[model samples]
Every structure is written in structure tokens, then in C-alpha cells.
Target: MNIIGGIFGIIFGYVLIRYRERIGGMLGDPAWAASIGGIYNVLIIVGIFIFLWSLTTMTGTSDFLFSPIINLFGGNTPPAPSDF
Candidate 1:
């Protein structure tokens, strides 16, 4: 599967490079480029926010996503104090 995928990728890349000028002329527009860039920036900012939020609100022993217990098993919420 990997070999087939690699061969296909090489062929696809070759075709893309061969027709890069034509493809660029067809696809390139200042307004389109600007819109795509704006969207990409927005997604990046949103991703950063999500990462920070996950870090902050995490209840497990480890602050970051992956740690010994957390990675091996799953999120371990801290146990409540015994009233007895």
C-alpha cells in the first residue's frame, strides 16, 4: 500500500509541476488569496485558543494532554475528600 501510494504521489507531483504555470494562472486571484489567508489565520488563532483552554481546564494530574497515567489509560479526575 505504501509503495503504491508513493508511486501515485510521485506521478501526481510530476503532473502538478509540469502544469504548475497553467494551474497557477487558473487558480491565482488576489481576492481569493486574501480570503484564504484570512481563513487560515482565523483557524490558527482558534486552534491556539482551544489548546490553551484544554490545558487550563484540565482536571487530571498532568496539566498537558499526555502523561504517564493519562496517556496509558484516560483522564483521571481527582478524587473527592472522604467525609468519614
Candidate 2:
């Protein structure tokens, strides 16, 4: 399941980066067209992030990448049992 989701993310990210102009036009936003540089840069960054993240996840190494952050926040502790 993780692999499937990662594959989809990679494809979506590639499409986003590859056809950003078409996507902006499809949104029908004049502001986007006028100030495309900023938006384009943002899209590129997001797309690249998604692609790399998916790649890591697909390889089952995302935990290595995220474990430090997770530990900083207290790690992956399970919820406490309810008293009921």
C-alpha cells in the first residue's frame, strides 16, 4: 500500500513540475499568469519535495529520514489505555 501511494505521489509530482504552466492556466487565475515566477518556483519546490519524499517512502527508508524529528517530538509512543 505504501509503495502504491508512493508511486502515485511520484507520478503526480512529476506531472505537477512538468506541466505547471498548463495547470496554472487551467486554474483560470489571471494573478497566477501575471506572477507566474513565484508560483512556478513554489510548484517546483513542492513537486520536488513530493517526488523525493515518495522515493524515500517507497524504499522503506523514510523512517530513517524522519526518526530524528519524531524523536525530537517524543518519538512514536502509543496512546495510553483508557480507564473505562
Candidate 3:
């Protein structure tokens, strides 16, 4: 399941990077077009992040990259038992 999800994520990220201009134009948002770096640039950055994350996940190395973030949000803590 993780491998499948990672593959799809990589493809999705590639699509976002490759067709960012078309996707942004289809959305037809003026703000998207008028941004400082442009919507395509934003999409490219997001796509790169997604691509790297998916690649790491596929290789089972995502833990190294994301452990700090997970720990920051307390994701590694065990759940408390119910009082009832």
C-alpha cells in the first residue's frame, strides 16, 4: 500500500511540475497569475517537495527526513489510556 501510494504521489508531483502552467490557467484565478513568483513557480516548488518525499517513502528512508517534523508535532508519543 505504501509503495502504491508513493508511486502515485511521484506521478502526481511530476504532473504538477510538468503542466503547472496549464493547470493554473484552467483554475483561472487572477491571484494565481499575479503572485510574485507566479503560480507555476509555486507549483514547481510543491512538486519538488512531493517528489522527494515520495522517493524517500518508496525507498523506506522517509523516516529519516520526516522524523524531526513528526517529533516536533508529538506524533511519536503513545496515546493515553482511557480513564473509563
Candidate 4:
């Protein structure tokens, strides 16, 4: 899925770069341009942060950072001992 997503991203980026001039002209209003750019930047930052955070969780650091949240949600308890 990651590979497929990366391929799609590359294709989409290539198309965007190819048609940037036409797209810019259509969105030429200063307010429109600013809002569009701002939203794009915010989403990119969030995506990068999520990817890096996932790496941390996969490496077992989630215990340090997420244990409280898990415990708060009642997810970290061990099973009760079985009676003989």
C-alpha cells in the first residue's frame, strides 16, 4: 500500500508541476492563493509528523509517550490470573 501510494504521489506531483502555470492562473486571486498554499503546507507538516511518530511507535517508544493515553482509555491492563 505504501509503495502504491508513493507511486500515485509521484504521478500526482508530476502532473501538478506540469500544469502549475495553468493552475496558478485559475487560482490567481491573492486571497485564494494564500489560503490554498497555507492549507497545503499545514497538511504536509501534519503528514510528516504522523509518519515520524509512527516510526517511533513501531520502535517501542510508544510506551514512553502513549502509555498514559492508553491507560486512560483502559487498554494497557494485563489479563487476570486464571484459577486452578
* Backbone N/Cα/C clashes per model: 0, 0, 0, 0
| TM-score of decoy 4 | 0.37
> Cα miss at 47, model 1 (Å)?
27
lDDT of 2 by residue, 1-84 (tens): 999999999999999999988876676545654565566666788899999999999999999999988988987888899999
Off by over 4 Å in 4: 1-42, 80-84
For candidate 1, the per-residue lDDT at 34 reads 68
CA lDDT scores, all candidates in order: 0.51, 0.85, 0.88, 0.58
lDDT of 1 by residue, 1-84 (tens): 544544554455555555555655665545645666643443444445444444444433234644665756755667789999
Local accuracy of candidate 4 as per-residue lDDT tens digits, 4-79: 5555555555555555556556655465446657434434544565555555545558578878889999998898
Give candidate 3's error at residue 28 in angstroms. 3.1
Which candidate leads the pack in TM-score?
3
- Give me the candidate number with maximum lDDT: 3
Model 3 has an lDDT value of 0.88
C-alpha lDDT (0 to 100) for residue 9 of candidate 2: 95
**Ten-residue region with minimum lDDT total, candidate 4:** 38-47
Model 2: residue 10 alpha-carbon error in angstroms: 0.5
Write the candidate numbers in order of decreasing lDDT. Answer: 3, 2, 4, 1
lDDT of 2: 0.85
| Candidate 2 accuracy as TM-score | 0.71
Q: Which one wins by lDDT: 1 or 2?
A: 2
